[model samples]
Target chain A: MAELNRLWEKRRTDNFQMQLRYWNLIGKNSGLMFVLYAMIIIGGFYYKRWLDGLPEHFPGLLLISVVLSALSVRAPVRTFIQKADQVFLLPVEPELGGYFRSSRIYSFLVQSFVILVAWIVCMPLFFQMAGRNPVAYFLVLAAAFIVKGWNIDCRWQEQSIDDLIPLKILRGAISFLFLYSVTARLFIAVPAACLLIMLLSGAFLFHRQAARGLLKWDRVLDMENKQAMKFLRFANLFTDVPQLKHRIRARKLISSWFPVRSFDREHVYDQIFVKTFLRADDYFGIFARLTIIGMLVSYFIGNGFYTVFIVAATVYLTGLQLLALWKHPLPQALAGMYPVSFGLKRRSFVRLLFALLVIQTVALSAAGAAGMKSPAGFFAFLAAGLVAGGLFSLGYTARRIAKENR
Target chain B: MDPVLSVEHLTGGYSRQRPVLHDVTFDMNPGELVGLVGLNGAGKSTTIKHILGLLDPFEGEIRVAGRTIRQDRLGYRQKLAYVPELPELYEQMTLEEHLQLTAMAYHIDRTTFKERSGRLLKLFRMEKKRHWFPSHFSKGMRQKVMIMCAFLVRPDLYIVDEPFVGLDPIGIQSLLDLMEEMKKQGAAILMSTHILSTAEQYCDKFIILHDGQIAVQGTLEMIKQKFGDSRASLHDIYLAVARGETKWLN
Candidate 1:
């Protein structure tokens, strides 16, 4: 049991460390961080002002209750059971109840933050509208904690039974009604709590009955693997996660865009890189998403230095993400055996980067220019984008490649 | 005629302070197949890496077709194809795409590439899987892709490492036949493997490596003469050398 606890601790630490490393990478990008912070502060101020000026007839309490209860009902347990657990820990299942108890507690603690934040955010609106006493608000918080713990336990019980979709829906609907009564300050709070307790007791009985049946180890492992991959995928957005196995799709239509006609050695690498960019799910998805985001940002900001800032930032990010593509061929032995000079590979990569950045720059600058009625503003933004693209591809990317090769 | 690959006193490894291969020396001439036999960690891969110009030799030099990797890097690389022990492929690339990429890298013209790839695909019974990505390939199918790519180049030399693992019996026979055909066409092959029987049957000569150095290298007849045993099989001679039971005349 202690060994299992230690293993769980180590796995959690490693996951936490991976997230921290990528977060630090994101933090290092000062331009993106500045934009993000600026947007958040501005948005928060507007939200507070709007809340203060709420109309008298607004059902703010009902809205808050519904959203909070919806959030509270989704209590996923993070078991942290790795694939090796099946082989190594199966024989010791009798002793794992304590380990699972710890896991449930950890899940409850982690999930409680959402309910807490919802309460805090909605508290200001609640007081302005309901004119409720501070004591009553604290009661709501305490009731929320109880409901959250019950939801976590119910979810854990639900996983043991296969073909329980209807049961899950019924539980969700019942929890929503109970939470709604408490948060809406209905006279049914006491009875709602009683009903919740009865429901939870029934769930416990169901779990006990199912516990005698075979454990669904495959389903549990699959769910756990998916949970871990979600975090890894998030971290991958900031920096490369080498352990993240990339998902590939044929995308036959999109791949047809990069027709292979090159027989020359240099052109062959260029073709391969382009085809890879178009066919690889992650790279193509990142490129398309960033390009669309840059265009949208430019459109929203209307014409100004902000548009240029967004365009430049998006280009940089796209280029950075595409660096992972170069690593694709690194593991392939035939790539190393290619008779072409190393410079040729670098040159082809630079060309591809330049082409992609230039396309992004043109589309974004054109969008910005459309909003700016002045031809001078349009030409200026266009020239700036071209220059930034050139500097990024020729100078920044070249230096990075040089550093890597060295 | 010059030997296709010449490694003279080559010494190298991942780190400079402690080289894995010490003074490794050998040569493979055209129309010959030399088996590089060694145990795991015996520096077969390190030696291949050095010959492929992936690592710089700390001492001595390697020449392919009379041109050193440094003296003519592109030309030296152009004359040889390498098949690694473990297949490493672009996960996103289909079988056809991989062959096309190989053709492009080796500067084979489009017409020649199409003809050769089609013939190889038919020969390997993989015509139906030309559009299948490596993610869908079984181990033998992936190995066939590597072998097809290597043969498609039609280079003067082939560097193969553990070529028989995961191959079906038919695949193995096809590979052996292709290698023999290449040998008849005057191409040199340097293959490293642990399958001693296959090595003895197919290889024209053997370079037995032990502890980072070549313990003995010669034809079966020459090896028998050197070991003073007329009846010993190559596997027996190899085991004897590996166990340090041979007394060399040198």
Candidate 2:
């Protein structure tokens, strides 16, 4: 018993150390903690006022909280416990139960603290609108807490919530109806009907898991760790990862145009970069995703067309220019062995960088111009893109070349 | 034959405060395969880094094909090729793409690249794998790809480090055979390895580094006379030198 306690303490210490290492490296930058809390408090007060007299937008507070919670949960906290390491540390498995139990308790307290506070403060508002007695409100609130707690615990255990698809959908419908119910007592039948529906739906969720019952709690934990690790790796993309799992895709067309195949070395280099851009998923993925999202955002927001065009163009160009510098260090290993000259490589990179900027600018500007009827805005937008994408990339390329020479 | 590579009074590291490599000197002649033997962190890599000009020499210059790197950066580098300790390929590029990029960087004519790469691919037994992405390749295969690319250029000086790692015995033999062929064609090879027996058997000269400095450098005959151990093998000499049991002739 004493040994197990010691082992649990050691595991907790190790976990704490790992957390400290990450926080020390990149401190908590998520504005969700404070900003969301403030918004929730302010929103609850406004919601109470509306619920007292005008009962239409009372559900707005619930919708807002759901959005905030969803964002908070998916907010990309990158510190993941490694499953492989856990497997290696399996000799201390007995101790891990207690350790994880403590973690589960801690997580429950911290995560639900905000929701609890919000519910308490909004009690008057929920009662005023729904015209519910204390007993009814407490029962509903109890049910809400149970559902939230179960969901959060399931998530921590790394079980797929997707497995409960129908139940989840049903619950989602019920919650939406619950939100709607706050508008009037006519909606009371809706939420009251949902309460019965939820108990039934939750039974289905538990039964599905029971039918193909898993004895491998460890495996469930492993899956949870893996899910956590995946999120961490995605977050690491914006930070430094020593061993990154880079998505590699081959492009054969680029190889065909090699050896430049022509005296106009500049033209050959231009063709190579174009092929590289088209073929390489890493480079192409960045450009395509940014452009697609930009277009979509513009479509939805209905304004800021020029803003989308320029922002997307700047992102694509900056990445290309920086890539030129990174490629510089690689060529050194080959430079001494082959007849490849630094001057030629420099020229190729410079030309490629310029060509990419030029091609993208023309394609994007034309697209923007076609949609935009304002001739002055179109031309001004194109010119701004040319300066930001063209002049900036070229200037940076030149600076890199100079630095390489040094 | 004239020496293909010469490093004299070289002193450099990644930084000034703590130099990884101290004043070091060695030479490799045409048709000679000289192995650089050392323990880990003993500056074997740092020495190669200096030779490749990935690092600048703080005190002395590195000369490839009888020209200082600084005097003619392009010309000096043009004469040598390096296969790093671990092959670092562009994950997005295929085997063929790597060959193509090397050909372009070296300015090989299209016809020549096609002709040479086709032959080299068959030589390395990687003809069918040309269009395969590097990510799909195993460690041995990735190392082979790196080897194939280095050999494609046929540079005057080949700077290969830790080549035996990630190579099957067959791959190792093939690489050694290629090195021998390159040597016969009058190219110089500066290779670093922990495999002393292989170095003893194949190398025309040896440079054993200890504590980031040259401990002993010469042919077997020269080392025997200098160390006064005529019967001792290369391994013995290396151990003795590393452990400070023997003093090498300055």
Candidate 3:
């Protein structure tokens, strides 16, 4: 409907304003950007070396990563684009075609950027194994990219791969064969024959899926687009990008923390912090993600006290970073006038922060120590986690006090 | 009854160098509904901010329940509840969670919190939607959530900035009735609004602020007497004060 399209446009405009506001608050931190680009370049180089042995695996891996990335991009980007004023634009639904097209195109480009880099890195490895036949490789790469673009667009329409399973399986197989045969450095005729078979198989699958579906592509596209938008909201926290609120049904597990009985202010504050951290995406997401990363590193890198130390540091950093926003901008109106005593409020907040740090550290350190078979390392890491958490809490309190006094 | 809120020689702004309100002073006694009138960028919010202790007074002091925040931070703050012009409920928090948090922050007992929260939720007709997050709420619903949170604790003073902007007619009536009931209990209200007709009907006193200073302050009859214009309405007086009408001043 015309109304829905208008709503989408208005939402986009409002989201742009919010993004600008956030950026203004935190001036462009170019250092973080530089570090990210540097990592990408470095990772590209590392992958190139790693692919020297099993060159056939590179294309398949790149294909999987690209598809997954495209699917994941929708959630955060959509959430970012949704504005509070979107209700006003609700009537312009008929014009949503333009908006959806532009969104899909933009998402495809972003999704492709990383894939292109990965492709470039793996290309050399393929050539080295298959002999430097640039023409054949370029032709295949071009075809693959075209298929990929279409695949992303299709995915955006269909959403889950289950909706078009045959197409997905066919695409996966073709991509697999394309990488496997070509990079195996087989005979030129063999690759040429394989490419022809893949082309026919993909064309058949596309036609089959395209024929069976009588439903409007736009409607499907809208649903897929919304699904993407939801994921984007969750992703925004990681990259300071826009996203929709990833609507997740909260699991009804351990619902015991309600209507806290502790009359003491400290206990009440603790319950508030604990309940929020335990249930919400924002707090637990950071804790879970950082700890997972630490566990991965320890698992792959060989574990010890060093592993526990790194996990502790990560857990502490996660708690500190997550709580940083709340401590700033001084809810100026409510901050000064709240019923609770300043000293008591600060103490409760610090205690809450400490509790969060303890949970995160204990979970990660225990996992790290379990991997390392070191109780001593666990104790050491726990101490380090506590100290780091305490210092971080103190720093926040000091900042608040200083701001108030000033 | 004692004055619930008093501002003396207040001057402050979002920034220190550029003051929005200059030498502004007024008082609101218990059970009085005082409308704070101002044009766009007339420093209504700035003055309210100073009163809430969000911004420090560059040249004055604000007292809620007869105690300045600086002198007795907790006691000063405990007497007032502020409903901002825009609802800023935590998007992640459910309506009930928001009420619970407010109750906890004010240290209300469990029994009192339950009773107050239930009554407020029903008053706003949001009892069924108590478990819903602000994310799922409409503009009016979000505003209702904010109103519920502000009223959950029976503070001596209620400072509401633009409370009627997003409400339905019934919601507006509900809010007015709630304020009326609170007033009967000797609570003081300092509400800022551009909605003249509503304020004119409901407010017992008016403080017309122009260019960050009090242009005039008093009950309707008192203001009419001072301006020597019994025929003029609150809107007329507001416009006269805002435009700095030479004749009215004379």
Best by DockQ: 1
Cα lDDT tens digits, model 1, B155-208, are: 999999999999999899999999999999999999999999999899999998
Q: Quote the lDDT for A243 in model 3.
A: 38
lDDT minimum window of 10 residues, candidate 2 chain B: B241-250
* Docking band of candidate 2: acceptable
Model 3 per-residue lDDT at B66: 74
Superposition-based RMSD of candidate 3 using all C-alpha atoms, in angstroms: 9.1
Candidate 1 lDDT, tens digit per residue, A228-331?
78877887777767777557789898788786777888876787688778776478888888888888787778758887787778888888888777776544
Q: What order do you get sorting by TM-score, best first? A: 1, 3, 2
Cα lDDT, all candidates: 0.82, 0.65, 0.68
Measured with C-alpha atoms, the lDDT of residue A197 in candidate 1 is 60
lDDT of 2 by residue, A47-160 (tens): 666665764645644543363234223211112335564466466655555555555565455456655665676567656655667775565455455545544444443332
lDDT (Cα, tens digit) per residue for candidate 3, span A1-406: 5555565567667766775665553445666568878999998788766765564534553444344334332321232233332454345534555666666665567656656665665566556655678886665555455545655555544432236666566555555555444444457776576567655654555545544554344345465467555445634644544233233334336435445565555554455455555555445666677768866665455456567567657865786666743443323333344566655655666666766667777776676667767777677767777777767666754465446532
Error of 2 at A326 (Å): 6.0
Q: Where does model 3 exceed 4 Å of error?
A: A1-259, A275-282, A293-336, A364-406, B14-18, B225-231
Ranking by lDDT: 1, 3, 2
DockQ of candidate 3 relative to the true structure: 0.23
Residue A104, candidate 3: C-alpha displacement in angstroms: 7.1
Error of 2 at B86 (Å): 2.9
| Cα-lDDT of candidate 3 | 0.68
Query: What lDDT score goes with residue B126 in model 1?
Result: 98
